[model samples]
Target: MAAAATSTSTTQLSAPYRRSSTLQNSNYNKNNNSNKVPSNGVNGDRQVMVSKRGCNGVDNGGGFCWKASFMYWTLEDVAHVARHHWILCLFAVGLLFFMAVEYTLRMVPASSPPFDLGFVATRCLHRLLESWPELNTLLAALNTVFVGMQTTYIVWAWLIEGRPRATISALFMFTCRGILGYSTQLPLPQGFLGSGADFPVGNVSFFLFFSGHVAGSVIASLDMRRMQRWEMAWLFDVLNVFQAIRLLGTRGHYTIDLAVGFGAGYLFDSLAGKYEESKRRTSLLLHKEASLT
Candidate 1:
């Protein structure tokens, strides 16, 4: 009878433990199923449906959809740009003002003579030129001397300084100038001063759209600055200004010609630098391949 009683007690205790174990297994299976995404064909079908919807949305909206995706500019973006590019914002305002001015400005009559502010400002120099015609010749001779200095410096940069960028830039600038100058020839300015000592001596026909003298000097000056030859750079800049004044005073070049010359010099120098960089990169890639082989 005691054996029977102990057996009944043991069975009763094990019954609750078995029930708890079964409940835990059921909970675990539910959690595992909830965590897992189904890998059946239905999931893939749903993904394809979503993708089709997106394509349809874009097709229906046309450019608007693309703009919405790419150009979602917000106030934060404007604030960020304003903080970083305040200078550009100021320039934008200036550009708008100038555009308005240009739109409102009156056009000069086709029969009217070409007018240049520099020419107007140098009225005294014009008077001097008229008073002593030989003064024009003297200034031309001085300008020739400055040209000689520019040539010497450019050549020296290649031969002595072992830097050929200035020479390369000059070559590019002159070639472009010749092409442009011949393509569109501008009429020579009136009240002109000619001299036998001037460049392209003996009054030879030359391109007047852009001044090689100014461009050459600018190229040399830029190279001087790159070399940290500050004094030489400053001297060249000063001489260039004087040369421009002389060109203006004597009507050797129109104001547009001188301005374009400065721009061309800077442009060609940048081109030369790019050319050197490309060459260096090519040589490096070749060396790397050769070593690997």
Candidate 2:
């Protein structure tokens, strides 16, 4: 009887230890379950990350891409979408109409120059306001900043297999046009387009120089859209500031053209964004926003 009682006491002592071990194992299994869940499972976090990263993939319905195996956009996609780029098309159409109207109102006498009342007024504004040393210095500094940033982007593109040829082309032509327009001043020529000192930023008439810049800038921006987010973010802001100043300040261009061109050039950049939908992004996308503000 004493031996039986001893056996019962031993059993009671071991039972609590067995329960404790089972509880410990259950807690371990709960902790492990979260880590081991499949990404496709209902409550997993990895699936969300994958979906977010999948933006702009080809065959993702409306999404875009630029590669074959990697889901990059085809040339056709860029062409079609770019053709209908809503904002650019709208802005271009508006500028075309405005230029056409300006053309009708302008007076190009054969004996003298081709400038009209509009050119006269714009020129007067530049002479009166932009001739100041301080304003000139500020604008010149701004122009240099724009030019330098553009160069940096192009160099980066050359080294990194990025799309910036058009942007660089735009910058080159922009610089060239500036020089040519400035040199042709003083005894401005007869053709409405070829000669004029009145245009503040460029003396080479309003329609041609402004139109070319707007057009070239658009093309470059279109090409740049193919770059990764970080690439675009790096340079867009610096470019925008110069562009705005060119449009708004009272030198070189018609205020109208400058205003219109800003939208057009900006539209070019926007088109690139749509075209390169499949490129990888970085946190630097915020630069697009920050630059404008």
Cα displacement (angstroms), candidate 2, residue 170, comes to 5.8
Per-prediction tally of clashes: 0, 12
Q: lDDT tens string, model 1, 1-293?
A: 99988556443312323333445447745764676545457654543443344322232322222213214335554565566668888999999999998999887787876878888987788778767878888888998999999999999999998999999999999999999999998888888877898997998999988989899999999999998999999999999999998888888888989999999999999999999999999999999999999
TM-scores, all candidates, are 0.70, 0.34
Candidate 2 lDDT over residue span 1-293, tens digit each: 99998555443323323333445446645655655656565434543443354422222333332223213335544454445565766788899999998888756676774443445544544464445646555655565455455555555665676565555455545565566547654343222221122223444233334444344434444456655454564356446545544433443444444445556555545544444553435435666778889
Model 1, stretches more than 4 Å misplaced? 1-90
The number of the candidate with the highest lDDT is 1
Q: What is the lDDT of residue 91 in candidate 1?
A: 98
Off by over 4 Å in 2: 1-106, 111-113, 116-128, 162-220, 228-293
Which numbered prediction scores highest in TM-score against the true structure? 1
In candidate 1, clashing pairs total 0
